[model samples]
Target: MRIYLKGLRIYATIPRIKDANKLAKYYTETNKELGIDVTLDKISAKEFIKTAIVNFNSMKEFHFGIYTKNHKFIGLFSIIQPNYSKRICEIGYWIAKKYREKKYGEDAIKIITDFAFKTLKMKKIFAFVNTNNKASIRLLKSAQFKKTHTSLKSATAFEKTGTHISTYVLHLAIYSDTKV
Candidate 1:
């Protein structure tokens, strides 16, 4: 099954094989420093697309391609490792370099968070963000996700040994209270 979720400036939907080339190109062009836990080695675009398809079909992760109202491919947003019994899940996302800082990420987060709580019946949705990514930190906070804690973790390609990763959570109650 595929999902099509809409927001003010963008919409998210499951990726098709036709989208693989574009998505792969975006992955190759994007700077690795965009996210702290970004992949260290670049995978061939087709291979990455294949993996995305496998994950989606296997129910391993819910991957959505973020696009503009006019159908411009912007980036990706995902629900990771959902725990139905516990009513919880994790989220991860990234925007193309040119699309950053324009509130697209904020809108995507809100859309996916709403889906998790309302459609998927999740009680909590959380994110693990690199502490050094100020833009992401700000975006999450603006979406009303509370900072639970920060911890140092293994280095990523762009980070040093003691990189700090912060965990943020948005419970259904908080989302309900702030949702308009």
Candidate 2:
């Protein structure tokens, strides 16, 4: 499936093993900013690709590759650790550093949220942004996700990564901010 939004296209097909270098490069580049634990360099693309395949194929996780209208790699969006019975999922995404401030994140969120409900049949989806990550908070807010709660000293991912976090949630059944 390809979702077109704001001139950007999100391709639902997961990258193949031959695209290992591309995945690895992306991981090494965005690992710090996105709080990922992988250190695989370009040479280790195979391992990174392997992990992605395992998570995607076996864990019931969904990942989409972000692309341009012309089909250029821009970023990634992952519906991680879904609970099928609960109809709940968490969205984790990161746009390339160069794509910052381009409104792509907002567009992607809107499209993905729609896909989550209409295609995935999900009831609720959520995102967690570090309090200090003002940009992401603004992005999520602009996407119409309600700021549900803030946790103090809650994050333990990276050095100086903000502990204060705000959880933003979206519910299809209650678009008017009804209590969940």
Per lDDT, the best of the predicted structures is 1
Q: Pick the candidate with the highest TM-score.
A: 1
lDDT of 2 at 12: 39
- Report RMSD for candidate 2: 4.7
lDDT (C-alpha) at residue 36 in model 1: 27
lDDT of 1 by residue, 1-180 (tens): 666899999998876656667776666566445542444223455566567678877867788889988888888888888778888888877888888888899889989898889888999888877678788789889999998852322222244456766788898998888865
Per-candidate TM-score against the hidden true structure: 0.82, 0.74
Global lDDT of each candidate: 0.76, 0.66
Alpha-carbon runs more than 4 Å astray in model 2: 1-12, 16-19, 34-37, 50-59, 149-162, 174-180
Q: How many residue pairs clash (N, CA or C atoms closer than 3 angstroms) in each of the candidate models, in the order given?
A: 0, 0
- What lDDT score is found at residue 22 in candidate 1? 71
